[model samples]
Target: MAGTVSGFGRLNRKRSSNKEGKRKKAVYPEKSPTSPLASKLPRKQASSGLPLPEDDNEVPAIGSIYASPPIPSAPVSRLPARGFAGRGNCVDDTVADNALTASQHAPPDSGTVVRPLAGKPSNSFRDANKRPRSLSLDTAETPSKRKVTAFSEDAALVPTKIADAHAQVIADEWNEVARQSGVPEIAKITFINEIDHEPVPPDINTLFTYLDKDCLSSVEVPNPPKAETMPCIGRHPAFTDEGLFTFATDCKIIIECGQDCSAASNCKNRVTQLPRTIPIEIFKTVERGWAARSAVPLVRGQVLGLYTGLIISRTTASKLIGADAAYIFQLDMDEPQDADPSLVYSVDAFRSGNWTRYINHSCSPNTAIIPVARGSAHESLPYTLAFVATQDIVPLAELTLDYDPSEAKTFARKKYREKSRSKILKRKRNQTPCKCGTLQCRGWLPQM
Candidate 1:
C-alpha cells in the first residue's frame, strides 16, 4: 500500500508542470504568416534571442506575450508619470510597453523636459497654484541713465527765462527794420539776452534830451555869426578840407556840422546822422551772450554803425550799477584835464539800443569807438558814438572793440610783471576770461 501512494504523488506533480507550460504557449502564440508586417519586420536570432536586421532600413518588431493592437495614424502626446487624476500609481501594461519602446529609440537626454511647438498640445504636468511661463516677446531691455550739466541747470532758472523773452521782443523789432532795409530774411539779426541788466525805459528819447542838456552845461557855445555864410566843414577843426573827420587827432573840442553849417546833407563827416546802410547781424556766441558780425566785407576806417541809447548823468549811472557797466560808454569828452568831473555823463545801452549794443569786448579789437558831436546841442557834450573798422573786416567776422584802450596797452608793457598783473586783474568781481582768440589776448576782459 505505501509503494502505490508514492507513485501516485509523483504522477500528480508531473501533471501540474505540463499544465503551466501549455498555458505559456497559449499566451504567446507563433507569428501569423498572413499578417501584413510579418514579412517586413526583423526577426529575433535563435542564439542571442535579440532582433537581427535583415537590411539597414528594416524596422525591428516588438516582442509581446499577446498580439499588439493597431497604432494610431497621429502621434499621441506623451503623458507624465504622475497623472492629473492621481492615477499614475496604477500599473497598465500597454502604457509601460509604449514607454519602454520610446526610451529605446529616444535621444540620449531622455530626462529633459520637451517644449511643445505652436498649436500642439503640451503634456507637461504643472501645479495649479503656480504662475504660467511668460512669453519671450514680453521681455524688455533696460536703458542707461544720462548725466546732467551745469549750463542746463542754470538755463532752467526763472530770471533767465524773463530775460530771454525780453530779448526776443527786441530782436523781432530790429528784424522788421532789417527787412525794410532789404536784408534777406535768412541773414536777419537775432538778440539773445545772456546777462541780467536793467531795462531801458520806454521814454528813452525824453530822458536822453534831458541828460544831454546837463552834460552840455560846462562848455555851451553860441553859434558863430558867419557859420551860415561860409562852409563850416572847411573851418571846423574836426573836419579836413575834403569834409572827412581825422580819426587820429585828439581834437578836444570838435563839433558836428549841424543846420547852422553851409555843408550839404551828404557831408562825409555826417555818417552817424543817417540810418544804417550796411548789412549786419547780431548772433549768439559761446563765450559772450550776443555779438555783432558784418554781413558784408568792410574796408579799414569805414563807418560801421552808430551806438545810440539813453544818455544819463554819471550820478544816475552810479545808482543803477550792476553787470550792465559792460554796456555803458563813459561820455568823457576830449576836453582839458582841469575840467570838472561832475559834468561827465554816460550812455547806458542796457536797453533801447541799436545793433552795436551787441558788440563784445576783445583784447585785440578790430573796431574803435570815436565820439562825434551831432546837432547843435551836442557841440559841448560829444554824445554821438561811432564805430569804425580799425582793420579790414571779412564777412561773418565778429565786430569787437577794446572796452578800455589803456588796459589793452598794458599787456605789452615790458616793466609789468605777469603775476602781479594777473593778481590785480582777478581781484575784480566782473573780470571774465577773454575769448577774443587773438594772438595778443590779454587773458582777461577789461573791467569797468
Candidate 2:
C-alpha cells in the first residue's frame, strides 16, 4: 500500500512541471478566461484544428467591427458680422442638414475626404465673399419704360408727290428722241421712218394663191403695188377670223396695209408692228445658259414679239464664225428660180438684239416664227419675222421654238431604223441629252 501511494504522488508532480514549462515559453501574457479584455478580443481561427498564434497585439478591436471611429470636426473661426455681405445674418438650414447627412454615411477608413454635393455650402469654411444673386427685375420691366409718340397732323397731311416726280425724272432720262434718235430705250430697236398705219386683212385661203405651184422653178414673180400708191383699207382686220391664219395652207404671202391705210393703229392685222407689250423675263436655266420666259399668259396664235437684229447679207453672215454665226437666222422666203442665194439676207442678233436671242430650241416648240410684211416695200424683201405663240402658254412658262422643222421627221425615221436594225439600241448622230422636261421630248435636242 505504501509503494502504490508513493507512485501516484510522483505522477502528479511530473504533470505539474510540464504545464509550468509551457506557460513560460508562451509569447503573450496570459489572461483569465472570464476577463472583459479577453471577451473583447477577436476569437482565434484554427489551422487544421490547431490554435491560432498567441499575439494579442494582432487582434482588431471589437468596436471597429460594429462601427467606424468618429471623425474630428474642423475648428470654426469667428469673423466680424459685417463680413457676411449680401447673404444676411441668418445661417442656411439646407447646408447644415447636407453636411450632417454626409458625415453620418461616410466610411471611416476611406482615403478620400467627404464633400457635400454641388450647390451645398461646406461646413469647413464660411465664404463671406459670396454675394447673393440680385433680385432686380430689370429685364421684365424694360419695355414699359420706352417713350411713345404720335405723328403730327401736318406731317401726315403733306402732299406725297415724290413718287410721281421720280417717275417723271426717269422718263426724261430715257426719252427715245433724246437717247437714240427716237428709237425706244426699252425695245433697243429703231423702226423705218414711215408713219404707223393700220393693216388691211386678206382672204386667208386665197392669200397664198398668188404664188404659183411652180414658183420655185419660175424665172419671174409678180410684185405688189407700192405702199404710197395703195388705197386705204377702212377698218382694222381680225386675226381670230377662222381662215385668217392656218398652218394647213402655204400661207406664204404676207401683206400689211401701210401709211396710206385708213384703219386704226390697234388693228389686229397690224399686230406684228406693235411694241412688245407682253411681259417677258430672262432667267438662268439648269441645262441651257439663259432662256426666255413669258411673265404673263399667252394665247395660241397671238403675236408675242418681233425678231429684230442687224439685217446682213447672207454672204457676209457666212463669213462670220463662232457665237456670231450661231445666232444668225436665214430668211425663209420663196424666191424666183433664178434668184441669187448670195443676195439672201440673214438677221444676226448676237451683237445687237433683244430678249428673243435667249429663246432656246426644243423639239416641240411653243412658239413659231411667222412671215409678216408691214408694207409693199417689205413684201419685196423676205417677210419680216414675227414670233407667234403656237400653244396656249401659262405665266412663267419658257418660250421655245423648233430651230429646224425637218429635224423631227429625221429623228422619227432614225428611231424606226434603230428598233429594226438590232436588239441593242443605237444613239442618234449629233444628239445631245434634252432637259426640256417635256413628256414628248425626243431624248435629245435636234442639231441644226
Per-model C-alpha lDDT, please?
A: 0.38, 0.35
TM-score of each: 0.49, 0.44
Model 1, global lDDT? 0.38
User: Which residue window of length 10 is worst by lDDT in model 2?
Assistant: 5-14
**Candidate 2, 259-367: lDDT as tens digits:** 3344433334454544444545544454654567776787776666655444454445445443334455655343332334343445544333345655776767787
lDDT of 1 by residue, 1-448 (tens): 1111100000001011122121111111122212212112222111111222344222111100000111111111112111211323222445433533432211212232322111111111121002112212122111111112333554333223332333333344455544443334664554432222111111111111211011212122222222223222234244333323334343322334444433443444444443344666555554565578887887665666656444443444444333333345555443223323333345555433457766777766777665555444323234456677767789879998766565544656765545575675576434456677888676666543
After the best TM-score superposition of candidate 1, give how far the Cα of residue 366 lies from its true spot, in angstroms. 0.5
Off by over 4 Å in 1: 1-172, 175-248, 335-342, 375-381, 417-430
Superposed on all Cα atoms, the candidates' RMSDs to the truth, in angstroms, are 52.7, 54.3
Off by over 4 Å in 2: 1-238, 241-249, 264-267, 336-339, 378-381, 413-434, 443-448
- Candidate whose TM-score is highest: 1
